[model samples]
Target: MKTTSYISRQVENLKPSGIRRFFDLAAQMDDVISLGVGEPDFVTPWNFIEQSFHALEQGYTSYTENAGMIELREEISNYLSGSFQLDYDPNEQLVVTVGASQAIDLALRTVVEPGDEVIVVEPSFVAYVPIVSLAGGTPVTIQTKAEDDFKLKPEQVKEAITPKTKAIMLCNPNNPTGTFLNKEELQQLAKVIEKNDLLVLSDEIYAELTYDDNYTSFPSIEKMKERTILISGFSKAFAMTGWRLGYAAGPADIIAAMVKIHQYTMMCAPTMAQHAALEAMKNGRQSVQEMTESYKQRRNFIVSSLNEIGLSCPNPGGAFYAFPSIKETGLSSAEFAEQLLQEEQVAVVPGEVFGSGGEGYVRCSYATSIKQLDEAMERMKRFVEKRL
Candidate 1:
């Protein structure tokens, strides 16, 4: 039998992750300065790591409850309430998953019926489109622009709505763009959602990474609590990317439905990781703040440097990426990325891979050390000068 014949049509239809492709190419080249990775370069905080070690030393290697350890859920609950004034009952409104990625997938798989239409704001996370497709839902993409700081506008959401629209997936402090949706902006979106009776999947994994202001949680919007599923995790903020832990909070019914899928598929999040997360939730605030400060400094430098090099980047309000326009370079986003990699040995993801509005730009992650960023910026500057 042909290999293609054996593959599920859903799986076959999906394109390989564009970000992963760049990483693979970068791995083969010597001395490549990569700005393509998304995770923090920092190690997991020492206290969190110590807690993980203590858990292992005590032989706490058993499975957690299907919904996760109650203590951990309580910590999550407290973190949400304390940090964002968002309240969720730890008992019935939360489900721990392998990571925020799994939380997003489970939420999509649980609520999306075949042919359901999901409004995806772009340039959004790479996973949203494929996840919606895998859930047998059709994705309707609404492209946000650089002029508006890439925020999803109420008018755009209103225009995208159809009778089939089931949910809206939002990535605040959005991946690639690093743009956040403020309170007033979310309120405008809330009105449209209320009128249409739609659900919301909010991916706020970068909630703690925002600079200049605190993050506004989707569920914090008046009357949006029951309709929103807030997805967050340890990966981005705590620098625990490899630990693979996350959770979802929302109405009990929807969370229970997601937990049903989780019970059968994942059983539960890793027990030791949950223990570490417990520690993180309890005392990791200072570590998170220090890291966010470092990222803010890097963000300022990168945005300044990119602009100086003739790439017009709108300063991102949150998260650690710089999305700089490459339009003036007279190259398509892909051509700019490819040639930059080949000539300058610097790897950055082409914004075109992010979705429609992402064309004419590139997403460079500032998650690495400043020294590496400095080297990459210098290399990029030389590359831009040559093209000029």
Candidate 2:
């Protein structure tokens, strides 16, 4: 049997992740500076590491309960309540997964039936559209505009809804653009969601990284608890990306269904990771605050520097990314990214990979140290000046 012929058409047709390719390229180079991958550059918090080690020493190396250990789930429930004023029952509403990535996939697979249409906001995380497709659903995109701060509009959401529409996936403190839906913005969308009787899959992995104001959890809104599935994890704020742990909280029935798929496919998230997460929930707030402060500083510097150098970048309200328009340079996002990598040894992700609305922009992650960022900025400035 031919290897290529044996692969399913769906698998064959899927394009590799744009972020992964640039990250891989940077890895192969000696002096390249990357603002490509969305992960935090910080190591996992020391307390988390200490607890994980303690857990290993105690022989806590088995799989947890299918839904996750009771203690960890309770900690997650309490953390959500204390952090965002959102309430959930650990036994009925939460399931710990391998990571936020797995939580997303499990959510889609649980709700999306063959041919269902799922509304996905564009300039979003790359995984949403593909995950919907893999779950046998149609992805209908709502392309947010750069001028609008890349925030999804209520009217746009209303217009995209169809008779076949089943759900909408939201990435708050959105990736690529680093845009967030403030309370009023969420209220506007809430009206549309309630009017259409639709469900929401809220990805709040970067919830702790919001700047300018406190972040409001979608499920915290009035009457939204039943309609919203909230996904969050320790990867971003706690700098624990490699730990591969995350959890989903939502309506009991929906979460239960997701747990079924998770039970068969994943069995459970790692027990040791869950132990560390429990400790994080209890004592990691200070570590999260410190990391967020660092990212905010980097954000301010990078955004200011980019604008000073001629690129127009919106002030991202949350997350550690700045999406800058490269339209003025008359180069496509992909072209600009390619030229920057080749010419200045700076690596950035082309915005178009986030979908069509991203065509004229590129995403710059400010999660690196200020020294690296300063060097990257100098190189990027040089690249822009030469073009101008």
Best by lDDT: 1
lDDT of 2 at 115: 84
Q: Can you write out model 2's per-residue Cα lDDT over 1-388, one digit (the tens) per residue?
A: 6699988998788888777776676777778898996899988888888998999999999888999999989999889988899889999999999999999999999999998999999999999998999999999999999778899999999899999999999989999899988999998899999999999999999999998888999989889889999998989998889889999999999999999999999899988888889889989989889989999999999999999999999899999999999988899998899889988999999999999999999999999999999999999999999887
Off by over 4 Å in 1: none
Model 2: number of backbone collisions? 0
Query: How much is 98 displaced in model 1, in angstroms?
Result: 0.5
Q: Report the C-alpha lDDT of model 1 over 1-388, residue by residue, as the tens digit.
A: 5687999988988999877777777788989988988899999999999999999999999998999999999999999999999889999999989999999999999999997999999997899999999999999999999889898899999999999999999888899999978899899999999999999999999999888876799889999998999999999999999999999999999999999999999999999999999999999999999999999999999999999999999889888888999999999998999899999999999998899899999999999999999999999999999887
lDDT of 2 at 52: 88
On the 0 to 100 scale, the lDDT of residue 257 in model 2 is 99
- Give the TM-score of each candidate: 0.98, 0.98
RMSD of 2: 1.0
Worst 10 residues of 1 by lDDT: 17-26
lDDT (C-alpha) at residue 330 in model 1: 97
